[model samples]
Target: MAASSWPVKIYNSSSITTDSLKVPLHAFIRAYDAPTPSIVVRADTQVFLDSLAFQDDGKVLGFDLDHDGYDRLRNTEVRYLIDVYMPTRSLASLRAMGSGDVVVTPSALQNTSVVLTTAGSGTVFVSAPSIELANLNISVSGSGGFQWDVPATKVTSGVDLSVSGSGTLALSTTTLDAGSLKMAVAGSGKAYVGASSLVNVSSSVATSVAGSGQVNLYAAGTCRDHKVSISGSGDAFVSAMNCRDTSAVIAGSGSAYIQSTTTLATSVAGSGRIYVAGTVPGGLPGSYTPMASPPVTTYNAVPVPAYEPHKTKFGSHVSTGTSWTRDNATLIGVLVAVLIVLLVAFGVYRCRKSGRACFRSKTERPVGYARKTSTENQAPSMA
Candidate 1:
């Protein structure tokens, strides 16, 4: 049964392995009750779209509703909600397009690829935490921006980023292990990437067109085989302590801070400066203070013991450990005291109810004989 008022359109790719399933951008996507354009892609038992406003070509699932239809629904009380569900661990891909603010949530895109492109004034936010992404590509053509939080692991492929206009790209990743990384910026665009663990860079550059472009790459752990460039007042910052075979080029009034432990090379022209990690020759440029190295990560390897219930002498299950005994000792003593008091009270009640003496006083008479009075004692002498 479908979960909404409308019927769901099902798409299955269980038998296909040649390429990942694709969801092309179409309608003004929404997440049920939200007012912005958004969607959620996560693992499910079945593959279906919680909407009736889409097209399925057995290869591509795309939204077909136009902006006019979206606007009409937005003005009225009707809601335009869409959610995409995929089979568990299945290969999938999504492309985010068009001219509005968009948000992709949960980042449960395991074994998935994503492409983001926008040319409007609104920003696109892709939240991917602790996922294994195969590939990610992002581009911005106007003043719109992109913010992606991808703490990716086991990524066997590369990441590509481009910004051709004045927009910004805030891309972050935690690379347990990954392949190459490439980025480019033009026309006053800015790109910022913070990568942890091992980071590999083929090329990263900032080229100025109408204004200066800037690319700042902050990497922790080992950075290997990096090629960075800056042209026409553009700037670059690469902060990695253990860099191997890194090359930097500055063409105009740009500056860079690159630290390499194995092989470091730089070429500068037109009043640009390059800062190395440590001491340099007398004719070389100034040195920079590198960021502190990331703390070493360690994991506990010991297996935890399973829990077992403790059996008491009466064959009743009780909690184990000294703390449990300590906590219940006073309560058990109180309960025993209460039981003794209740037994004494019950015996007294039974003696009174049956017209018998439960306890004797010193002045009381015996059970079968009366006590002698003072007159009986005097009469016994007379007799």
Candidate 2:
């Protein structure tokens, strides 16, 4: 489908080279090659423009978010889109802080180490298949979703994923070939990992509410070691069929599932249980539905709604507003001419009846009437 085109406001035009960029507003960032780095922001109101900031240096570019300033534009029809142009190298990291959905383009990353952080009530879509990072770190700490679907991503060192608050970090279908993988979840958050072969995998979940913090690990191949810790009502599901060794500790009513072929070292407290896969009473938790990755977005201009022109309290006038026109002046002149003709005709009629000349002169007069002297024309003395 063709992308819509909306009006754009270039907030930051001067290009600066930067490897790390931060977007703190509701904007879409697309990466393109250019001589220097630039940021293009499109917004309906000046509020977003007023709160925009850029770094003078060429290393790090930051956009500061003003809470009160952004809130004033919350209920209005304010849309934001940002275009980012970098050098030939890829953007190394990104930090987004907003409640506005932002979609990152795939060509935005070509680095060995990339770190992405998201906060606020917005969702960030990262679906770059060509991304190959040595170290990948993702952290989410708000009521939002961080959808990372880089299945072909290869991690040489480690991979870290964490979720707090009522957020989710979904990477279920993503395959990672890493040395070690670490996952953590707290509060009412959730985490999902793909079935990948790893040397070491560690996961921990702490939750106070029922069906809260949950972690699901799907390792189809060989795993050197797997470790898990659960507390409160949290649960962990590990599907490593050929794991060499496993260690797990559960407290409260939590549960852990390890399908290892070698040794198992576990500690349980209260009603916690350690079971194998498909051995549960009924089935896995009904609430453990996999989170699907959001569709990739094409950075096209969004359509803006049409609105009527502004009107004044005096009402709208199609003609030349409150000023008079040449047509009005011509009409007024015609009326004055007709009025003068009528007054002259009336004076002639009155003169015939009174038997006097309407225009007074010193010598000229009517044929039957005598000429009026200066004394007669003037009024008598007041005395």
Candidate 3:
């Protein structure tokens, strides 16, 4: 229906013609209510507003009797309705449907017995509910998707459905084509999807499976955690990487407990613990293999020798060694010390050639640059 609040003018009985009838919002509005600005529907009937009241015998006149009251009713569309022609389009709530294909709506409450049944190949979507469908068989054919707004309270076999929430969906029967099903949990919600045969899932964050048949989980990922509890006759195969940002735990407790039918190969950082109560007829796979039978009875014993203490060789060869990593800094320090000693020795050798006085007393004074002295003795002129 076009969800709006307009002045509703529909037909009423002859008994309620002259009498006043209060109008309700959206659907029900009666005659002689008011003669204000209304959606006048007097085309078929002879209903008209002569005075402040309606002058009709069958049709309803939805105008205000008081001028101010009509203006107030226009603002607040109470006791008014627009024509409803809401064809099913948006997938909302769903109830127990017939054995045929159905559409979706929001008001499909749980008490309304919400379910989507398909007799043919068309798709059907429904809201999640924990109710009963005593003798209802819903068949969704190949290559079709059925989405439930909420997680199912209870479900039946041959039903391929997807739920989007963190609510628990109790599985009454196995969800066939579980790989075809798409599910997303809020944080770390749990799902117990089991089956009699193989359940092939395409994309799911976290889900648990426990049934007599194989459970194949594929393309499952999420930022939160998820887990699967297995208690069935067949092996559970999680083909997808059951990787979560938080902790994800998978457990198995059964006679034929096969935690991984496939290889669990990853380089991520996590811990996995295994516990086994009793030994099974079949041996544990991979790392949990059993010990070999037919224990060795005896062997020729060798005499033990003593007194062996060899020196450790650390360089090039085992037998012979070299000074590859000897004291380099010590050698450099020795060389520097030798250079300093040589420099000191050279300085001493040059200094010993003259008296230990000022450099001015080392050589004969220069003739031109000689200092003036009153006691200067001039040498005789040489020939």
Q: Report the lDDT tens digits of candidate 2 across residue range 132-169.
A: 56778887766666776665666676778877666666
Name the candidate that leads on lDDT.
Answer: 2
Q: List the residue pairs that clash in candidate 1.
A: none
The 0-to-1 C-alpha lDDT of every candidate, in the order given, reads: 0.45, 0.52, 0.26
> What are the per-residue Cα lDDT tens digits for candidate 3 across 1-383?
22223223543233322222121111111112332212232211111122123333333222223333333333331221222112222111222111112233333222322233221122243333333332222222222223333332332222333222111221322223322232321111122233323333333334333322223332222222223333222222332322222122322221111223222211111111222212322443332212212111111111111111111111221100111222233234434543543454345446545645212222322222222111212121111
TM-score of 3: 0.22
Q: Which has the higher lDDT value, candidate number 1 or candidate number 3?
A: 1
Clashing pairs in 2: 195-218
Per-residue lDDT of candidate 1, residues 218-293 (tens digit)? 5554545667676555555554434555667655555565666566667754445555544332333322222233
- Backbone clash total for model 3 is 17
Q: What are the TM-scores, per candidate, against the unseen true structure?
A: 0.52, 0.62, 0.22
Cα lDDT, model 3, residue 35: 25
Candidate with the greatest TM-score versus the true structure:
2
